[model samples]
Target chain A: GEEVAQTPKHLVRGEGQKAKLYCAPIKGHSYVFWYQQVLKNEFKFLISFQNENVFDETGMPKERFSAKCLPNSPCSLEIQATKLEDSAVYFCASSQSTYGYTFGSGTRLTVV
Target chain B: LAKTTQPISMDSYEGQEVNITCSHNNIATNDYITWYQQFPSQGPRFIIQGYKTKVTNEVASLFIPADRKSSTLSLPRVSLSDTAVYYCLVGASTGGFKTIFGAGTRLFVKA
Candidate 1:
């Protein structure tokens, strides 16, 4: 079985501060995806990566949010100048193909 | 992108069968239908997937109609632990490979 690992299960930050979340995809998985779940709502796609290259960032907020998958390093999502609305459970998922996906437990972010 | 619509919620009892249906009228020819289950405070887990006809696994079964416009996920003999939100997704694989989830159906299994 494959598992995606997410760090900082819970995080509390002040508004306007910076928040960073990390995710380690399952070994041998080639595609990584980030999603945001707000207030128990549907998961919203944020960005996706193929290996170290970003394949799609259409769902990401261009100005304040950025994600990267460095060589041999776990993927990271960084949010600058966080707002109250930024509070949500961020999930990371990885898959080798289209049929199945393995997701991390998720990181809950609370901004006040 | 194929848009999916499912019931907002459903109720069932322990030892009973539960079937959740999803509709995707604009599904593409190459799109696949996948179902996922999510418990509170956790990520969605894959239940089953199907391209057409019927596919069954240990956890659940997926029945896709001939037109591919709709599909049903059947959970047999559900238990209290089966109470959670179930999401149905329809999408085509890109070079990046992404799956988009709709609002999903919430299943409440009573003991």
Candidate 2:
């Protein structure tokens, strides 16, 4: 079975500080996506990347959030000036094609 | 992408069949219905997907009627381990770059 790997299962940051989460797609997969789950609620799409290029980032907060996926390197989501509302579990997922997506356990960020 | 509606919660007994329904009245022709299951403190895992008619996998079965306005995910002989949050997503079948998720249904299986 293929698995998406994520680093730093837990992250704690002070408000107005910065936090970065990392994700590695399953071997041979090209598409990576980011989603946020707040209070164990719905999974909110943050961004999507096709290969090393960003396909869509409509859900991303441009002022404080950005993501990048470089070839042969794990993808990363960086958030600057974190707010209390930014506390949530950020998940990274990858798919060989567009049909199915495998998700990482996620990085839980707590902004204090 | 189409809006999906599902029950907020469901309760089932162990060893019984559990069926969760999702309604997507505005589904487009290129859209497909996909389901995912998530346990506590873990990310969602793909369960089953279907375009129309029926699709059955080792873990669950998906049934879609002719109208495609609604779909059902059927889990047979469910155990306690099957209890989790189930999400039904409707998105373009091919080259769908954007995916939207709904509130989903929380299933509780009891002994």
Top candidate when judged by DockQ against the true structure: 2
Question: Model 1: per-residue lDDT, tens digit, B1-111?
Answer: 888999999999999999999999999998989999999988999898899999999999999999999999999999999999999999865346566789999999999
Across residues A1-112, which tens digit of lDDT does each residue of candidate 1 receive? 4689999999999999999999999988888999999864677889999999998899999899999998889999999999999999999998886667888999999999
RMSD of each: 1.2, 1.1
Which residue pairs collide, candidate 2? none
Give per-residue CA lDDT, model 2, range B1-111, as digits (tens): 699999999999999999999999999998889999999889999998899999998999999999999999999999999999999999964442777788989999999
Model 2 TM: 0.97
- Candidate 2 at residue B98, lDDT? 70
True contacts kept of each: 0.54, 0.59
* Per-residue C-alpha lDDT of model 2 across residues A1-112, encoded as one tens digit per residue: 4789998999999999999999999988878889999974777899998889998899999999999999879999999999999999999998876567899999999999
Q: Assess the local accuracy of residue B78 in candidate 1 as a C-alpha lDDT between 0 and 100.
A: 99
